[model samples]
Target: MAVPETNKVMRLLEGRHWELREGPFKRLGEGADQRLREIADNTSLTNYLRFRALIALSLYDNEETGVHLERHARSGIRPLPAEGFHP
Candidate 1:
């Protein structure tokens, strides 16, 4: 079973109240770029969350995010929430 924290995160990633997901990380600045990259690149994570990390990375000036975005864009991920999808 998924850990409680991870499970909650997965729930919030789905189409729901945006704040639960955004509020915590919205204030995060460039400092989070590296960690966000780690999350984006963590193959063990659900693709939905991985893509979410990429979305957050867009707020910063990290060039590496572009590469992740390109890879995800080509990954056939639809612009949908991270509920029952994986791409």
Candidate 2:
């Protein structure tokens, strides 16, 4: 998802305004972790899209995913979700 083509696609498809979560493609399972990481790390993508990738990663309950969200918050990408919101 960090690739230029994917970045361009994101640019073309990002929402005009914030909307509630409609969710990303699911059923990808753990194999998608690395791609999601790339998506979350791609600064070219809007925070909204990157944030969706991060939220997908958050489902794994992995420490690194947590770190990504924290870093994003500190970097002003977006605020970290409140605790227990998804539990």
Candidate 3:
């Protein structure tokens, strides 16, 4: 599936207001390790913790900022403009 176009993903990676919960950073079956290594070799994510966190955020169920998003929407607050939509 196409990744959601939410800046919150990057924001979660950057350690901003939203925290990533129930991510997908566990064992990835057989050849998954090699795939991960290849990806790490090509990408900029240096630290394993950060990389795993990123994978968890992406490869798994993802974030839980519904309450936060609702608050922002209600109060007329917006994420960084780069995120596109306010929610």
Candidate 4:
């Protein structure tokens, strides 16, 4: 079973309140970037949650996050990594 905190993080990631305000590759501002980074670095979160965080970061044009997602995909994980997703 997933931990409560991890569930909460996942919920937050999917929640409308935190939805990306712009198109992919658009900057989400510093606050949003920091929040995504926080979620990405949180070891307590499930890999799925971490993946979502990385996706969110990618939408903000974070290249490093895209690379991390690619690595996860190469490892053959679920939710399969996105391809050709620059930004």
Displacement of residue 66 (Cα, Å) in model 2 is 1.2
Model 4 per-residue lDDT tens digits across residues 1-87:
222343343455664345543443233324555566677766676555565677666555556556655665676544423432222
Clashing pairs in 2: none
Q: Which stretches of candidate 1 lie over 4 Å from their true place?
A: 1-16, 19-30, 71-87
Candidate that would win on TM-score: 1
Better of 3 and 4 by lDDT: 4
- Any runs in candidate 4 off by more than 4 Å, and if so which? 1-12, 15-29, 62-87
lDDT of 4 at 64: 56
TM-score of each model, in listed order:
0.48, 0.47, 0.25, 0.42
Q: Judge candidate 1 against the unseen true structure and give its global Cα lDDT, from 0 to 1.
A: 0.57
Cα lDDT tens digits, model 3, 1-87, are 233323333333444343445342233333333333333233354344334333443443323323323434475533333333222
Q: What ranges in model 2 sit over 4 Å off?
A: 1-26, 76-87
Give per-residue CA lDDT, model 2, range 20-52, as digits (tens).
332332333344555667777876755567666
lDDT of 1 by residue, 1-87 (tens): 222243443444455333334555444423455667676667787766766766666665656767767776787655435445454
After best superposition, candidate 4 residue 17: deviation in angstroms?
A: 16
Candidate scoring better on lDDT of 2 and 4: 2
- TM-score for candidate 3, residues paired by index: 0.25
Give the lDDT of residue 10 in candidate 2. Answer: 43
Worst 10 residues of 3 by lDDT: 24-33
